[model samples]
Target: METTLTLKDVTITYDKKPALEQVSLSFPKNRITAVIGPSGCGKTTLLRAMNRMLEEEPGAAVEGQILLNGDDVQKLPPEELRRRVGLVFQTPAPFPFSIYKNMTFALRYYGVQNKERLDAVVREKLTLAGLYEEVKDRLDKSALKLSGGQQQRLCI
Candidate 1:
C-alpha cells in the first residue's frame, strides 16, 4: 500500500557526460517492475544512483533525489542506506565461505547474534531466493562447490 522506492528528477553524470537524465519513477511495495532498454541506456546507472552507489565512482555525480521508504537515501549514511536497498548484480559472486556462512555473514554484519534468529533468517532468505531446496542439506559445504547457476541463485 506504500511506495518502497521513489526517484524524482534523478540525473547522473560521469566526467561531465550524462548517464541518466531527469528520470522519475516509483516502486510500490511488494510489486515487481522491470527496466528494459538497450545496453548503456542508463538502466544500471539509474539503479546505482538509487542507493548512492554512484558516489563511489571517481568522476560520477548525481543530482536530484532518491527516496527509500519516504527518506531521501542520498541524505542517509551510506552503510545504513545500503542495508535497505541491497543490490544483487547480474553475475553471481559467492563468498569463499561455506553455504551457511555466506548468508550468516550478512546477518552478522547487521548485528544479528541470536542463533535461532540467524538460522531462521538464513533459511527464510535462501528460500525466498529460490535456493533453499538445493542447498539445504549442504549448509556447511563451500559455496564455490555449487554450479555457477546454483551459486548465482544462492547469491540472490
Candidate 2:
C-alpha cells in the first residue's frame, strides 16, 4: 500500500521536558493505525504534532517532519493543514453559533467565501460524519442545543 502519512524522527516537547524522541513511522493508505500507550507517553502529542495542533500550546515545540501524501506539513499553511487533517479533541467545546456556522467556521477560515459552496461542503462533511441527517432541518438552530452525541459528531 502507498503511504498516506509519514513521520520522520518526530519529537515533541512541552517546556523543557521531553515527550517524544526520535519516533519515525509511515501510515499506509486506507488503513487504520493506532498509537496506543499509557498516559503522558506522548500519544496525544504525536497526533497533535501530525496535524500541527502542537502550535496551539504556549510551550509545545515539534522536531522533524510530518508528510501528508509526500508534502511536508510544516511547509503547508496551518489553516490548510488543519483543514486537511481535522482533529477531534477528547473534549467537545461547542462554539456559540448556529450549526451551519459552527460547521462552516473552518471552511470560512480557509477562505471559502461562496455561500453555495460553503453550504455544500458543510453538508457533505456533516453527512460523511453522520450528523447532517440528524440536524439537517435545524441547520440554522444553535449548535449548543444538540444532544451530546450530535455535538460529538459535529465537532468531529
Candidate 3:
C-alpha cells in the first residue's frame, strides 16, 4: 500500500506538558484510518499534529515531522494546508452567530463572499451532512440553538 501521510518521530506538548511522544506512523492512501485509544492517550494530539492544528493552541509544541505526500507540512502554507487536511473534532463547538453565519464564516477567510455563492455552498454542505431539511427553514436562527447532533453536523 502507498502511504498518503507519514509521521516521523512526532511529538507534541502543551505548555511543557507532554501530549504525545516520539511517535512514528504511516497512513496508506485510499484507506479509512482510525486512531482509537482511551481518554488522555493523545489521539487528538496526533490528529492535530498531522495538519499543524496544534499551532492554534497556546504554548503548544511539535517536534519531528509530518509529511503529506512526501512534502514536509512545515513547508506548506498554513491556510492551504488546513484546507487540504481538515479536522472536525468529536465535540461540537458552534459559534454564537446564526447557523448561516457559522457556515459562511468558515468559508469567508477563504475568499467566499458573494451571498449567492455562500448560500449555495452552505446548502450544499448542510445537505450533504443530512442537516439541510431539518434546519433549512431556520438557517438564520442561532447556531447555538441546535441539538448536540445537529450542532456537531453543522460544525462539520
Determine which window of 10 residues in candidate 3 has minimal summed lDDT: 106-115
lDDT of 3 by residue, 1-156 (tens): 799899999889899888888999999999989999999899988998888888888999999999999999999999888888988788889999999999999779778889999999999999999999999999999999999999999977
lDDT per model, in order?
Answer: 0.88, 0.88, 0.91
For candidate 1, the 10 contiguous residues with the lowest summed lDDT are 83-92
Candidates in descending TM-score order: 3, 1, 2
Tens digit per residue, CA lDDT, model 1, 1-156: 689998899888999898888888899999987888998798888888888888999999999888899999967999899878877776778999999999899779879899999999889998998889998999999999998888877887
Best by TM-score: 3
Per-model TM-score, in order, reads 0.87, 0.82, 0.88
lDDT of 1 at 1: 69
Q: In lDDT terms, how accurate is model 3?
A: 0.91
Residue 27 in model 2: lDDT: 93
lDDT tens readout by residue for model 2, 28-131? 99898888888877787889998888898999999988999999998999988887887776667779899999988877887989999998988899999898
In candidate 1, which residue ranges exceed 4 Å CA deviation? Answer: none
List clashing residue pairs in candidate 2: none
